[model samples]
Target: MQRIRLDAAAAANAEDAEVWRWFSGLLEERRVRWRYMFSRWVVNVDRVHVATEQNFYDAIRMAKEAATRRGLGLSTIGCSRIR
Candidate 1:
């Protein structure tokens, strides 16, 4: 996955920064190379090797699930390929 759009409601929360920090940390712990852009509303994940698309999607799913488990309500609007 190259880009992910975060949920608007979650992005506007007062504790958004902390949530982002935790999310990014979780991604790192899972060995996913990603960074925030456009004021943290967008996440850019580094390119994955060919034929590893499932792994990338799994990482995203796990992160989203973890966030939801923590009551964060995190959601991705979309994910795009880098080309």
Candidate 2:
């Protein structure tokens, strides 16, 4: 499995004061690898999402499976559909 990374460092420079402050909450930097069941693909990422910390492994598996089963690409897991 290959590891992928999703860095949110761009949030550090967020124009909105509230957004920038919120980004500050991500004090830790990390990454995780997710295996795709139906393909040779994997997702590596890092962020401050609660679901990521609590059920990241499962979430990735579900996302990968969902994409593969539906014959879609990474973009298939849209930002609004991740939950």
Candidate 3:
């Protein structure tokens, strides 16, 4: 995995900052660099764009956990569906 795009609707609320923080921590764990851009409509919604690698599955689990904790929607959150 060379990238991960977090779904904005997954955590669309002011109370979700903890989830964002956890997601940031996961990025650090994978040593993946990321850029975030706020999506239109809801200001609480944004994407966490990450750059990772093939062996990043270990971090994927943690990232998923963070996403889930942050109210990740059923929508795709993987790299393949990013673009």
Which candidate leads the pack in lDDT? 1
The model with the greater lDDT, 2 or 3, is 3
**Candidate 1 lDDT over residue span 34-70, tens digit each:** 3333333222332331111234444454545454555
> Model 3 Cα displacement at 65 (Å)?
0.3
Question: Which candidate comes out best when scored by TM-score?
Answer: 3
Q: What's the TM-score of every candidate structure?
A: 0.25, 0.24, 0.27
Give lDDT tens digits, candidate 2, residues 1-83.
12222234444334344332322332122233444444333444342222222353445544444444544333322256546
RMSD of 2: 14.9
Model 3 poorest 10 in a row by lDDT:
37-46
Instruction: Quote the positional error of residue 79 for candidate 2 in Å.
Output: 24
The candidates, ranked best first by lDDT, are: 1, 3, 2
Clashing pairs counted in every model: 0, 1, 0
Q: What do the candidate models score in CA lDDT, each in turn?
A: 0.43, 0.37, 0.40
Residue lDDT tens for model 3, 1-83: 22323444444544356545555654444533432334211111125422232344323434455446666422433436535
